[model samples]
Target: MACLVRSLCDSQPVARFQRRCGLFPAGGAAGEQYVVKNYFYYYLFTISAAMGQEVFYITFLPFTYWNINPYVARRLIIMWSIVMYIGQVSKDLLKWPRPCSPPVVKLEKRTTAEYGMPSTHAMAATAISFTFVAVTVNQYKYPLELGLMGAFLFSTLVGLSRIYTGMHTLLDVIVGSLISALLTALVYPTWDLIDHLMLNSPLCPAFCIVVPLLLCYNYPKLNHYSPTRADTTTILGAGAGATIGFWINNRYISDALAEAATHHVLSVSGEMLLTMLAKFLVGIGVLVITRQIIKNLALKSLCSWYKVSINDHKALQQFRIEVPYKFITYSSIGLNSTVLVPLLHKLLGLN
Candidate 1:
């Protein structure tokens, strides 16, 4: 990724520095080539956050406001924090210099970057977008196609911002977005499972063992497919439910969290835990009253939004399903799922 970015910086749309002979230093780059390069990289940087802000704001946060709950909020916030932390670590571990000055991007000022691969903004934004949408749709209900489009727009603009500000090469931002997104995707759900284990270990083993079996039992009658297909559908269903749950929780936090911020008597950790616990209580209550629509919604329903059939084995790996993106998925799942699920079994928390 770094090499690709360097190549881009050196080759196409190269931003000429001050010729190492300028009388005064410049804060921004100048020239159309540099502008293009930066814009491309910036787009890479802002993706997840951009997508997250839209889904979370329009779907999750507003819905939470209308409902007025906080347990979901706390969990969502913690998860978001996790995603943010992952982005930070990835940035440093990757240790690419900022493509440019990391400026407040504008139309002009094509600043050159020092290290430009894997734009942090892109990673963070993408994480936020996925986590927010994950929580929202997983938890509540929303228009699907329109929602995805909106998320895409937000992420795209964020990526563009990187370039407009001359903060990264196109390759840098693109690679960054992909790296962050892929990494997050692989990790978060596993995190949720780990959380579930730590919080509810005894039941987790049974739950993990049973859900798939039960899903297998009903696999044929519910949809009637082969083991491979049945397994795929079940996996999709669980994922869909998790995403929905994630969204419901995230939406509540994005808006109401600010209010919780006002009640900042405790440290960040205390406040987060207390607030999240409160949210969990609220979610439980809501589940009781709504007959657990948010809690029980099927991935089949979610799949309908994307025109994915429950039995479509290819879709799980191929289609752009709107999975609920929580912060834990970015951090915990990244670490836990692959290591355990492949070797032992997979369970769930909020992934």
Candidate 2:
């Protein structure tokens, strides 16, 4: 208990440096000096963190599952993958220490061990919020004010939450937000072009899957203290899976849906709502099962082939074992999202 208190209360080197540089107030316990000590701020930031989590984003999966808009679904998948890839690559390359580390701000979440120059949370929030606004307002003809205001408020709160939690500095938040904005602007315009080039071509899906895998395989090595490779692998795998799934859907499922439009799966609003709920439940269940099975199989096969015990952490550290496992698992998820779920809905006469 004493040690835990010391860890929480002691001034980190980064905090001290920030104090010297006038970024923070000098001369008190880290918590005492920071505005985050207030209960309101703490709770607010905590909620913001939760909002930026991957699981929170999964709520948007129903949009795709219900076939609300295929274009929107595709954009969501691609945007998520791109933001994660860029944010993680930047984190690894910059190798900046998190404010929570010793000689930085007091650690809020001890399990957080990654570098934190530009916070991925901030970047993701910005990317998702911005993309949502752009899609809804410009493409879907939603009210610009409503879309912009909501996205701006959400993204701003998420960015501020990072600072309040001592997870990122002001500069980190700014950079993260800017990176998202820039990427969204560039990528949004190119979506139509990419669809034109890749959607109809037989060879394009193969290229998409191979290229991302190759990139992950040859990803740059970290020069400083290394974080787990699991995050990167997951992103790559999901991207690959989405790529393949998009192709399959574009070629097969989409055409079938168009032709089946006259079939009239649901005749009333209540039935449509019920069908959407059922699809969400069933689709998510399949996705979870697929992810777990692939992860276990990959781990077991790799362990056996490499002559290493599954429990041997030190031995596993020497191998880039997570790459294949994450790729397969997330790809299964992506493929399931775009192809399997839709097919099931059709076969069940729900859509």
Candidate 3:
């Protein structure tokens, strides 16, 4: 893949086109443009991740590259279930032939004991490509034409690599790419709604930084998961409840107490510190009660209405830092929330 792309970057025709377009100004330096371009496409991961963890793809080119967010792994997991698992099961049921064998190549042992029908890596890469599309097209001003061309070409190459590695057939890779693209189309609408809605508020930090993170860290599904619409709603509710409780406690409750203490319309004592304590407790009580009701409703919505799986204790579990750095890796697993969380934070100001 790198070879073809790198070769494309070095092509004389492409160089001529760039020169004609004035995109490769002589002042920009020669010879290194293609190398830099290839670096951006194939090796931009050097500093993207947190400190301490790095990796490199030893392709025809053999240098370490930084790891993409762990959440990409999560996204692949979900994508695989949709594309690989379901597709593989369908083939088993229908008895599809293997490409390597007259029937199929001998199935390889997977680390997690999962079967392959469609290609997981292919689906995941395709999903990431779609998300990059949503980010450039829907979230940012990056040109859609270039973004899509890159995404499609990149996804295709990644898919093909799986076939060359004997992990999947060409048919499996194609189906996986289709599955990812389809899932991206299905989810991004709801995903975009969350992104464009709450980015600028004081709670933007909570939605973007806190919620997606907290959800992903909580893991049994919640851990390492990014914030969802349900999480955003709860954050909004909690923020509102906190704001209101603060106003009521500070303005009314405090004044009311001062009046009782001094028998005046309003009075604040120097020594009545316990009263402030009481007010603070009341505010916390309001927050807790409201949060509980919201959590219950969220659980009910998933369990009763949507029939989605619910990890009831997800919110309370401790995040594992096992292989400690893998935590960052795991968080990048699911692009559903990944694509939504940032755009939600950028476009909406719920705080």
Most accurate candidate by lDDT: 2
Between candidates 2 and 3, the TM-score winner: 2
lDDT of 2 by residue, 67-144 (tens): 465565566667777887888888877876666533354425532567776777888888878776665454454578
Cα lDDT for residue 309, model 3? 46
Quote the positional error of residue 209 for candidate 3 in Å: 18
Name the top TM-score candidate: 2
For candidate 2, the C-alpha RMSD (Å) to the true structure equals: 7.3
Clashes of 1: 52
Candidates in descending TM-score order: 2, 1, 3
lDDT of 2: 0.67
lDDT tens readout by residue for model 1, 23-137: 1223545333322334334444344334433233223432342233333333343344444434433443455554443222232332232234566556655655565555455
Q: Report RMSD (Å) for each prediction in the order shown.
A: 18.8, 7.3, 19.8
By TM-score, how accurate is candidate 3?
0.33
lDDT of 1 at 287: 28
Show where candidate 3 strays beyond 4 Å.
1-114, 193-351
| Candidate 3, backbone clash total | 42
lDDT of 3 at 150: 84
